[model samples]
Target chain A: MENPYLPYPVRIDEIITETEDKNLKTYKLVFLNTDDEEKFIFQAGQFAELSIAGQGEIPIGIASSPSEKGFLKFTVNKVGRVTTHLHNMTVGDIMGVRGPLGNYYPWDRMEGKNVVIIGGGFAFTTLRSSIIYMLHPKNRSRFKDIHVIYGARTPGMLLYRDELTEWEKRDDIYMHITVDATDDPDWKYHIGFVPTITDQKAPEGNADTYAIVCGPPIMIKFTQPVLDKLKYSHENIIMSLEMRMKCGIGICGRCNIGTEYVCKDGPVFTLDQLNRMPKEY
Target chain B: MNVIKIDKKTWTEGIGRLQGFYRLIGPVKDGDFYQFKALEKGESPDFSMLNTRLSPKSIIYPQSEVMFEYSLDETRDDCHVIKEIQVEYSPQVVFGIRPCDAKAFLLVQRNFETPEYKDPYWIRLYETTALIGLACNTPCSTCFCVDAGSGPFNDAGLDILLIDAGEYYYARVNTAKGEKILKDSGWSEETETKDAELAIENLKQAAENRITARISTDRLKEKGVPDLFNAPFWEDVAFACINCGTCTYVCPTCWCFDIQDEVRGTDGVRMRNWDSCMYPLFTLHGSGHNPRDAKTKRLRQRFMHKLKYYVDKYNDGIQCVGCGRCINLCPVNIDIRKICEAMNGFEPEQKSI
Candidate 1:
């Protein structure tokens, strides 16, 4: 019986300020022990509890793909006390990461299908993980096609700028990056909300296609209809939910939408699954 | 399945003997009501009360438990590293517990000891303790254990069931743990199996007959969740609730918690405290978005979770064991039985032109 509450120690390797407001930062962490890294097996769309010594723990999506070896990445928003402490900490500072918690994207069902990623603003962390995962050379051949419709309030608020730029030049994956109302003259991408771009650029739904959507509730709420209008069935739309979580193993009991504990049974659910549950979330 | 007859004169001696081998906890009169507390040396568990005010769940999952301790001094060897603290899992006995309260542990154990993950703190304490239940000879006004998959003499959760026989007690050993306790306490007065069974059955029937409250759960499993969630009666149910959180605190099946860090200079301990859904902060997100923002939503969540969600998830009857602690302790007189009836009988309103 292993202790699920115990967190593995990691040291902050690098921190990158993501947005213009300085509210979001991507922290690259390396495990203090090689054994800990070997034990931390995770997939895209899963999350972890980032623990601070005297401040509390917060559940954040794991932004790094497992294909990228050596370190784990978490793009944390400076909204609460623990995250604010993490934002103020310097490199080489030690912290705790306690997961690989929650379910991940349906890669088993998603094999040999087109993946359309719809994301907006700060909710793009795990989407970034999924994109990087699908783009890896060894993994690219397993999927048919990849299309991304991502947006932010402005060009300055978009995350993973360097990766998005490099992805734009790739012929293998179709990338349609957009900003709500950007005035930057150098911006060559689309100019609209995610739902609008998704409507215009997303592939027509078929049995061979699946869409993974993660974003603000407003973005998800609006993107759902566009995907539906494109003839995507309820089972093909995958979503990640947000809830205030304590013990990521589901014992804490606060993150339930219905009988399902989002920390254990989900964070990832198909629209078909969510339809059967209460709309409280 | 062993029955031993113990005289009332030797009950205190047996308790004192058991105390030497294990930590003893049971209901004792505190101020105006009874509560479960650890018995000190030479102290015996008082067994005359109908029920305790607070549940004995705190014995397994303490209200506030420290999980880890750390030092922020940077000069210390374990600086900045949150290390799991050493916890004691000593053998214990909960003597004279109600059958309903003991049954709550079984319902709550499903959450902590799931197939995927197990809570070491809760599991360890629960496994090491022996539950000695005192069968209800007189049912309380608020008690409705029969409808909740439990009864006055329910042995589902207890290791041993003790039947009060006026001048003596019939200790019906239900598990290996119960037998061990009897052996350790040196109580070897054996009773006829058929005779003890007949006597216990008669007592159980009379006590159950005294319960008049009925909770209908037949339609709870079949009701549309969205219709129940959006029911108009929720407003009436939540109208008087002050969100004081007394209902959750006194509930044995409510297991939600909040983790925090308390600091004393350079030393700190990370602990988890009991949290309530009745509070606005329970479901509030870090991004200033709260799904359960209003008290109506929170109140709905509490009932839906206990009566509907738990029923659907485990296909067990309900998360509650019908202990009636919440009914007795709630300041606003909110009753779960009434809410359960509304949900079980709810039908969506029809739209008209």
Candidate 2:
């Protein structure tokens, strides 16, 4: 039996700093072994544990679409010991990754439905993956209209600016970008918090609409009510959770809200499911 | 279906004979309390005690176990490659373990050997060991095993069940492993009549009758999750808790663990250590957010996971084996029996918010 805890080595091929503070960087990793690449298939909302061996390991959501093959991408924030070590690495440095763990977003459930994605800060990684997946030419016709509401604390903190710019130019989807308050003359997007912009810009919810929200806990706490006021039922609103995880597998008991292990049962759950779980998370 | 009798006078001889075939482990006096340890050349188990301070789980699932080892020597051809450390699985017998402790292994096995994933380290050790349970002829004041799906003489998870019958030990061999141990020990004496079986049954009944404590778990499943999470009694129950990990460390069925990597010079080993939910760090996120940071929430998580979550998830009884180690060892004397009864009997009030 293969050890689930063993991490496969991968080399960083490219690194892009997404924030002005240089705290968040997107790394494109190519597995050292081709067999590992063939075995690592994951959906948008799933996460992987990135490690620096002697330092430690931390769970980071996959930031690139699975439809784009050959390499994996992770957007990391330099917050703790592991992340600080990860952010200091260059293009050729090798790191460890163990994953494709946890359940993904309910893409099949949202097929042919009008989709709305709401994101804030660095929490936009998985939501970005989902949006890119849905907009891919091969899968484009499967869904109806798509809308995105993303924000950060300031213009300097906004991630994937180039991609957001490209997305804004496209006629296929509606993209609403914002910041809490910004003085940048080049800032051409809306200016407000995520919840306020979500209420003002997001399409009114209906039975055919599926809204997926991902952000800080405070953003999620405030966004749920806006969606509810927009007449979104518990079943139609989806969100991805963030929890401290060790083993991406279900064995480590830290990520459980009730009986459910977030690493296994979800990083993604419907608002209806969240309503049934304890408020600990 | 084999029955053997070993006289008290020749018990050492029986142990000596078994030592030739397998490594022996049993409860022995450790300082002021008793703990399960590997028996040495002349050590014998003290069966006079009701239960050991800690369960015999470490014999199979050790508190800190190494899973993989790697070297970072630059000149070596296979340097930096993580290789599994080969563990030798030798046949061993855990002798004189209480019936409740033996039964706890079966409950823990459900988590370690699940359908989707099998923990190789835990499974390998578990498969190579044989459990020889000693029937509890004298129940402790805190024992409630009878109300928790295991009685004083429960044979659900034991390979062999031994009852002290005054002059000799009356052993009921339940598995092929148990039969082999008896056959190889050279301590067998056929039962001449049904007298031994009748005496064992009467002793089991008497032992169970001494247990006056009971906990109601039937209503736990019927209660709503939100109601249980927002119960008013949590603050009162958790008031005295000092956040010490004694309960989880001494628990028979608490299986939570944390993985860590240790490096020394050029060599490194990845290991897992027993972690408790009572610690605030257990659920602390990397971004400085802790969901169960409060003492009341941590206390609720411990009991809720044991009494409510495990019951709902496995569709079985509570995760506790009712060995009462936590009750006996808690510095603050936070009794699980009282807390369980409070949870089981709670009637939720509608949230005004």
Candidate 3:
């Protein structure tokens, strides 16, 4: 029997360097063995523990949708040791990845609902996976007016800037971008925090919408009141959570917020679910 | 080497057969407390009361355990730390381990003995220990192991189960190791009669009905959140909670832990320590934020996890033995019964295939 504990050695076919930020990069990956490709499966918003050669595993969300089956993808920020090693890898480098574990975004319920996506900083990576899955060719029409509000600290830190620009142009998406400080004139947009822009630019409280918020703790705290003022219910406000996870499983006993394992029970939860957990980070 | 019965008139011969074990642990009286203790003198263990002071979680998943040892045996130039583990111990016999606590060992053994994160320290203790499961003659208010599929005389993980049949114990050998011990002891068998069956039933009824409190977890399992999330009821139950985690520590099945490195000068050992979700730091990271900070939030977490999350994910509740040690030892008297009763309203939708 194959050990669930042992990670399958995977070959990194391609790497997509998005933005000039020293931290973030997106890798386009496929199984080395063709048979494994057909057998492989993962849900949007689920994560895998990826291992670089000579470095151990680090949990990163499945950045590409299950709909994009030809290749597996992950958008990682080189904040720690393993990621730093991953950032130095070339096309043919071999690494290890061990799951498609954790829950998925409620796409079945999310369909036809006016979705408002609020994101700030590198935390937007998991949200980006949800957006990609929702906008696929077969599923795009099922969703109502989609609004994506994204922000970063500075022009130097803004991830997916070109993609954000194209998204802003598309008639389908009601997209908005904000930066904490603008360094140059090339960027023509709001010059303020994401919460500030969110309170001002969003198409107000009239429609039925599920507000998907992801960002730094400071941004999440500030944005909660803006959403409350806009009359979004706690159940309707879904947010992504980040914790110091080691096993990325419920067994490690590390990610217990109250009793919920953030790695298994969440990484994505409703504000109502967050209300029940311990305040510890 | 078949089934054997020691005469109830002379139970000492049977106990004498277990004389060679380095440690003979049995339920003994300490003031008013009846707990698991080392039995240097051969005496019949006390089982007329409730469970022990601890749930036997420490024997396998110890509260404080050394993962490995680092040693330096040379002077000056040759003084470099060599990792070593003291993985040997004299075989021990534990007396009167409840069915719930015994079954909990099944869940705990998998993690420590597995290929991933092979904790040799814990595995050593497990290998050397022999369990003598005692039948629960009086189930307390906190027991729900029967709901988790363990009974008063459940022989799931034991080498031997000594069922209390009023006058004397009815011994049942479960594993090869236990059968070997019995075969080595000179004994003869009498056919299991109807009288023994009647005595067993009487013990079961006394254990269940004598305790005035009851919480039907089956109803809680069927009904999920409506009763559980009502903050007012949860607050009432947990109002006196001091967050001491005594209930969790005494709990035979609360297997949560924390890993830390103890550094003394240039040398250090990484150790895994017991932790409870009730604590503020159980979920706290170096970052200045916590999700389960307050008493109400922590209380909600404990109830929801045991009643819903574990069942939803693992297909079986990990809380194997419903040993009431947690309830008995909880300083605040925060009863799990009231909490489970309140949360037995929302039957969560079954997982879609």
DockQ of 1: 0.69
The A-chain TM-scores of all the candidates are 0.99, 0.98, 0.93
Ranking by lDDT: 1, 2, 3
Best by DockQ: 1
For model 2, how does the per-residue alpha-carbon lDDT over A1-281 read when each residue is reduced to its tens digit?
Answer: 76787888888999999999999999999898999988898999999988666666889999989998989899999998888888888897777788888899898999999999999999999988998999999998999999999999998899999899899999999999999998889888999999999999898889999999999988988998999999998999998898888877888788899999999889899999988898888
Classified by CAPRI criteria, candidate 2 counts as medium
What lDDT tens digits, residue by residue, belong to model 1 across residues B269-350? 9998999999989989988988899999899999999999888888878888898989988889999999999999998895
What are the Cα lDDT values of the candidates?
0.92, 0.88, 0.69
**lDDT per residue as tens, model 3, B1-353:** 12334566666665666665446678887887777767765676666657767666666666797543322222433222223434557777777888888888876665445543454556667777878788777666567666666777677778788776655667777777776666554444654656655666677776656545455666654543433454356677778888887877777666677645454544545456788878877765434466666887776777676665555445565343566666777887777765666665443345221
| Candidate 3, residue A274: lDDT | 77
lDDT of model 3 at residue A215? 90
**Runs in model 2 with CA error above 4 Å?**
B74-80, B192-195, B351-353
* Candidate 1 chain B minimal-lDDT segment of 10 residues: B344-353
- The model with the greater lDDT, 1 or 3, is 1
